[model samples]
Target: MKRMIVRMTLPLLIVCLAFSSFSASARAASEEKYWDHWIERHAQPLDASNASNKDLRFLKKVLKGKRIVQLGETTHGAGEINATKVRMIKYLHEELGYDVLAFESGFPDTNASYLNMDQLTPKSTMKNSIYAVWHTEDVVELFDYMKEQKEKGDPLILTGFDIQSMKNSFNVAATQWVKAVDPEKAELLSQSENDFSTLVTDSNTFDEFSQKKEKLVKNYQKLIKFTKTHASELKENLPKEPKAYEMFMHSLQLRIDVMETYMLEEMKEKLEEYPENIEDFSFFMRDRMMAEQFQWVADTLYPKKKIIVWGHNYHLRKQNTKMIKDWVQLNGPNMGDYLPERLKKQTYTIGIYAYSGASLDSSDNKTVKPVTSPPPSGSLEALLKAADRPAVFVDFLHTKNKKGTSWMYTPRTALYWGYMEEQMILKEQYDGVIWLEHITPSVIIK
Candidate 1:
């Protein structure tokens, strides 16, 4: 009887100890499940301080046989993430043979142009010409990295609609569209086109937009020539004169002309309105171009490769995979929904975050802020405003101040609160998502 009792007690004690340990771990890991710190900190690598050694080890450990890594936003906000990224990239290319870096910040056509060595020569009207020449921060970093990779005889692939221009193409497209909807308005649209065209022609500064890259210059010239040829065909087919928005197959040519022309200026203009010209630009990129173009290039370029696009979170959404997902379940094109079940989790991942601890509003910080996701049906803006106890309006309507100090820009504060009450105003999707893992010296730690 004594021996049996001792055995029973020993078993009970072991069970109790196991339970206690699990409870502690559960408590600790609850944050990883709840808060997005680990993912967020990934924007900068933990091995940053000793990047050369750390990055090499990291690549070997994590990305040994990656086929695609569409994005890696290692800007780390304000601190210097470039050098660290360069080191990691060198490791990726030199050691692991991850050779390509695909950029979605440009149009596929532009990719062909860049490859062809097009001379930019931007028009005074099209603003993207400037950024294209000067290049945005990310663009510049990518260019530098690409150049270095090439010096090492490595391959690089670039893709995407050139920023605001994609969003801005809708304006020009709308002109053609509107004319189709209303026959009577053909003459009016023609007048608008004549006016816009005359302005473009008169602007000698049009050539001021230089095609810095040879491939881009060649592409531009090709597009210009294509536009002129297409314009003549559209004129020939139209009744009297082509109405601005005629729904004919030939109108695609007109659409392309409008896109390339506006591409020249979308970023140059101040476009804060909903029905603005910029919207026209965006529509052209989203609605007309084949998303397959980018996907095909990515598939070929990667081929058992691991890459990091460094694009906005929206592009990564594997959930609502395609622009057409809202309409079709299994049909049409949407990468977000089509990822294999295993890859789905990583592929369609996204990180919803609050980027604190930095002066996030600088023009240089353009890559970080604006929260990638748009205000969902005005809910984000609405909820943010309503929850703001001391809500401040800047110019009243269109934009509300975040809170505390309205000097140059309003700072975002506790508005992330609404997500708690299940009253979260908006729920945006993410693809290949993770949050910042650690607070860097450049940003403040909340």
Candidate 2:
């Protein structure tokens, strides 16, 4: 009787153990099912080499009839990422007929230089048009490509939408605008030149402006009054034969207005103990200004033309992901948030991600290299690699009937400026993602 009981118990225990193992395997497969289906079945491999037209057909199909395509980078300066951007620009221009290439740069710094590209060599224009950090081999290649296109008489519209001007290009352009229209009132523009100069310094300029906030406000007011008073004359002086000058001035004034609004918001935030609201307000305003400028470019400057904007993933995302969601909860609705509202289905955004790479650290005057560590468990990067692909493009927006993707609502890892966020909402923030298994740092031009 004892031997029969033991034999029955041993068999039952073995059966139970087998069932437990199977259950665990099923759970593991379920955990990875969504990412696996997307990457393995749906995602396309992308070759970023300039000579490869292999992916162009796939890219064109994805971007078909889209008026505005905003392609974002994981970092500001990465060699493969920038090369990919340039390649996309070339493809979109040649295949899809995209003519405008909007950039994330100061308006007064890059616009006039690009518009007047004929007067300057590509090398000179690049050095003068953008900040020193962007002076890379990759960027130089892009500039040379633009110059070549311009020479072909199919000139691309190159413009910037940032406002970090070290030289007070706004003041220079503002003074020129007034001089062109109303020379007598041009002297009045110099009334705030000293204050502008104070804001123009390279060292701790934002801090300096905060200290003299009232003076900056007053200067903004003075410029506002001058422009409004001579609005008619300024409009009259605008050249009709070639409207680039008018476009440049209009953009300059718009940037000045945006900066003034930002400063005012910054001053108001000074009253709060935790001024997270200030940064949020600044971000919203800056993005709004960028969207406004792009709308102007689309409507007035080049009607019905397709445009592609290249910038950091944070700025280009359609939804405000974990990047801005700090202790301050209500941070965004960012630039990407505003742009898609206006463009609707016309806007298509692609965010780039790298699993591991070296990031550029330029915080100190000295440029150093920082190695990016691999993502933690259950992170987006980890899931992307589960597909066993070196590079992948997942079009979340275009894919239909995708199952079990609700997991994307949960946070995933995102890296920006040598900082990593472990809770970025990957799918909600972008229409698609371009994932690279490994990345290299952008070559800094001495």
Clashing pairs in 2: none
**Could you give the C-alpha RMSD of every candidate to the true structure, in order shown?**
18.5, 9.7
Supply candidate 1's per-residue lDDT for 364.
44
1-446 per-residue lDDT for model 2 (tens digits):
99999998999999999998677546545655666665676667777652767766787778877898898987776677777778778888888899888788766667766755766777767776776666778888888889898889886778776755545444444466578876765655655544544443322445655556556556556656766676677656542325555554565365457446754455455543234554357656777777676667766776678988887777788766345352125546667666546575688899888877765654532354553566766666677776677777877776543344534544455655434553566667778888878777777775
The stretch of ten residues in a row with the least summed lDDT in candidate 2 is 196-205
- Clashes per candidate (backbone, < 3 Å): 71, 0
Reference-based lDDT, residue 394, model 1: 18
User: How do the predictions measure up, each by TM-score?
Assistant: 0.41, 0.76
In angstroms, give how far residue 111 of model 2 lies from its true place: 1.5
**How far is 307's C-alpha from truth in model 2 (Å)?**
0.6
Name the lDDT value of residue 34 in candidate 1.
24
| Residues 1-446, model 1: lDDT tens digits | 99999998989999999998676445434432322322223322334455356434533544434455544332234332333344445566667666555444444233332332222222211222112322334334545555445446564433343322332222333334335544444444444334333333343443432222222334334434543555555445333322221222223343344435444444233232233443244333342232333444445433454555444333443343222222222223233433445443223132223222221332443433323233333232332222222211111111222221111121111112112111111122322222221222233221
List the candidate 1 regions with Cα displacement exceeding 4 Å: 1-45, 72-88, 108-141, 161-290, 299-307, 320-355, 359-446
